[model samples]
Target chain A: MSTFIQTLHLAWQNTNSLLCVGLDPEPTKFPGALANRSDAIFDFCRKIVDATAPFACAFKPQIAYFAAHRAEDQLEQLIAHIHLKHPALPVILDAKRGDIGSTAEQYAREAFERYRADAVTVNPYMGFDSLEPYLEHKDKGVIVLCRTSNPGGSDLQFLDVGGRPLYQTVAQRAAEKWNTNGQLGLVVGATFPKEIELVRSLVGDMPLLIPGIGAQGGDVEATVRAGRTAAGTGMLINSSRAIIYAGNGDDYADAAALAAQKTRDGINAYR
Target chain B: MSTFIQTLHLAWQNTNSLLCVGLDPEPTKFPGALANRSDAIFDFCRKIVDATAPFACAFKPQIAYFAAHRAEDQLEQLIAHIHLKHPALPVILDAKRGDIGSTAEQYAREAFERYRADAVTVNPYMGFDSLEPYLEHKDKGVIVLCRTSNPGGSDLQFLDVGGRPLYQTVAQRAAEKWNTNGQLGLVVGATFPKEIELVRSLVGDMPLLIPGIGAQGGDVEATVRAGRTAAGTGMLINSSRAIIYAGNGDDYADAAALAAQKTRDGINAYR
Candidate 1:
């Protein structure tokens, strides 16, 4: 099995895109036409995938979106569909799961074996042992949440430990110790440019799953400047609501494709 | 719509037990009789629930266990069964979920609406906003992860922020600012008695879901002594593998009951 990072790089090269389409299908936000379907979420997501596939380096389905609606079957089907139709695109299951050893193993199984996610985002609050379970799956990727793209992200992440911010320590730790299988990645929100630069320098060329690009108001230019490695690779700039919900009418799929293409071009121009 | 704490207190008073039996069914560990059965995980959990219901103040089914086996339907059945048979006991879904606002809302829905869990564990790494979505569910409990029970827990948790450890900061923040709905709780491991004492004092009478008792080798006396409030009524000692996997025979459920009873009595003696 190819490493998750290698698979992601292949997808990036094939699509010429850094844009990762976040497949978070909130039922209330769906296009009006799909309101009455038995499997509306899955049907809606299939259209989004069909429209946006060519422009995405990766597809991220925030598990909460599926789990919330008790629509995990849809999520499973979406992942399988993405794999079958767009094999080059890596899927990141954005479920920030963190726990002790035994339980962590189960979560690892959920992401890798059950959903077949190429990568899964995890919280590092429980320390290395919690992360070890995820890391044990050598071929799959473990994207550790560093500095998230949210207002409250700073509450705990920006704490000064020793002389550096906690997120910096997290970045340094992930690169040095936790990358044993060469399957580790960092999640730094595009909203914080300086932190992105700080983290980019720490992890070298390891992939950065950079959210906050679209819906969360992260600047594409600054994100491209700060997050990319010297080799001009290593970022998955994700856009969820902005691209997927661009049109709330029956032409939503076409709108999603156009939005994805625009975002992909925006990142490319900056690069 | 009684607050989760009040509901927990009522159950604690009625059951006269502080023991929370963790219903994490690993398929590989199942006894011979149920090994080949299609619905083995659910069947195994049902018997365990029947045997141990009398000794528990709460039942915590770790979501990873069910997700790993793709036996979520069983998990759903188990939770529904627990609610139907033991209506007074709150089911705490041990899914250490952490995400940003909109996504957090979906996770909140998953835990409360879908699973109908009374309480759920959440990681505090992403800060207050990540937690707010869970808190919005007024009557449900928000148990934040603090001073976890793993060897690597101290790696990030003990990092000093200004004058206090990060976990202490987390505890202080959760108690003072985040507990607005009066539905907040803390998870301090039984393995860390001093940390338990530290957290218990900080949170006052807020309940503590203390794991690490049985398979993790936490001391019952130390846990009860350090974790109890002045009223001696603020701790739920959890034991998963040690109790559930006690005897690998036809009497596995009986063994689980015996282990749970012993753990309960041990906690009682300390109280």
Candidate 2:
């Protein structure tokens, strides 16, 4: 079995579900009870982790939200807390880092070594050289941007490179050429279910990180249908704001847990 | 005049030189005197800025080094100091940030609205939408990664796409299509002089941020030859480590000043 399949098996056993809770703690959107305090962000994340740890397979923290508030240290602390508290739960640093050569090496060191994330999201514009550094961490996964679940993602990703859209070519290249370490995955945004199907076909058995199911208007049923690999082996459905900030009061953690359970139920129902 | 031409004129008038000192203050490379302290990084950068201000048209700070040590706050303080001390010196934030749509807008806000940099480097992988936010700042320049200086850059950049290398196509697109706001420039690494010349031909008059000149073994004369536009515009030759860490003692500032002067002299002699 591929490393991705083994990760899925572990995720399934740990959470009894494939729900990936997104830890995108935007400061402005923080609950009134925790506003104006940086530590509140950590508090909020820790509580969510505690509440949903039993129901979620992995935790994906969007780096941009933390970076915007100069909360890198807070993020590091949160990741450490996740590892220490729930050692089996994988931490995917959603940094979307892509650069060339030595700079790429530095980023790999920053994300995997210093930050100690189990996986990282990378943009494939600079091509394979950028991905190589991340793949060197054989035990960790390198998720490449295939067909993103955003409004403007189609603008460039769907551009006709030859007879087909660029993203299709990217998916094929990633599956055939770039998976030397068998640690490759593609981020197929949940919003674009049709593109998800196309990417699924191209990438074959590679794991798919299907984001945008909650706040981004992606149909959960269609995403599950389109993103599933052979025999449904590789799909990580991610929901950030929908799960974390499901409610704004003292019941936030319960609300998050309920949201996560609902997403898992939705996926299972479709299956 | 294009923003590129205007910047060239500004450089010639203010510093009487085409040199840019890159403040890539890696914490690991710092002398034993000021090791592992955020304040020390700022102090070191301040000294370099003060000493090199007269000889350099601008200062470029690689955000990675600061971020590596979790010294972004220190970097912000140092940049604020540079603005106050040398108001005429343009500060370029070498951040190489790119994302899809709304996320890119947030990044633009962080780099331009918050950091207040005169210019910020960006990647073109996610296409025009990722860059749209940066272009909204009419006066600030956006340096797009065209053909990088690293040895592994050519792995994908030189791939044949419609009978031209991908980088050349990017240059053409930037010049003809993406420069709608006239705020676009290209980062052509000094190490790849021939490719730099090719990109120059395609870009016509777009300003180029030429990195990899000093410690990266790029020939100063050859870089200038390939980068300068027909009107003697474009080209900002950046030297980071050689200028910033010229000495390790209290007299490091003086050594940095001398180094800056020498680099400027080299460019002028070549011109």
DockQ of each: 0.89, 0.40
Ten contiguous residues with the weakest lDDT in model 2 chain A: A1-10
Cα deviation in Å at residue B208, candidate 1? 0.7
CA RMSD (A), model 1: 1.4
Local accuracy of candidate 2 as per-residue lDDT tens digits, A1-271 = 3443466568766566768899977667767888866588788898999888888888898877777667778888999999999877788888787766556777787788778888888877777877888887778888888887766676556656667777887899899998897888889888888988898888777888888888888998888888776566478888888999898887899999998889888887775
DockQ for candidate 2, C-alpha atoms: 0.40
Q: Considering summed lDDT, which 10 consecutive residues are worst modelled in model 1 chain B?
A: B1-10
Candidate 2, residues B12-73: lDDT per residue as tens digits?
67677888899877656667778755498898888889999999988898776777666778
Interface RMSD of each: 0.8, 2.5
Task: For candidate 1, write residues B165-248 as lDDT tens digits.
Answer: 899999999889988888888899888998999998788888899999898999889889998877777888899998899989
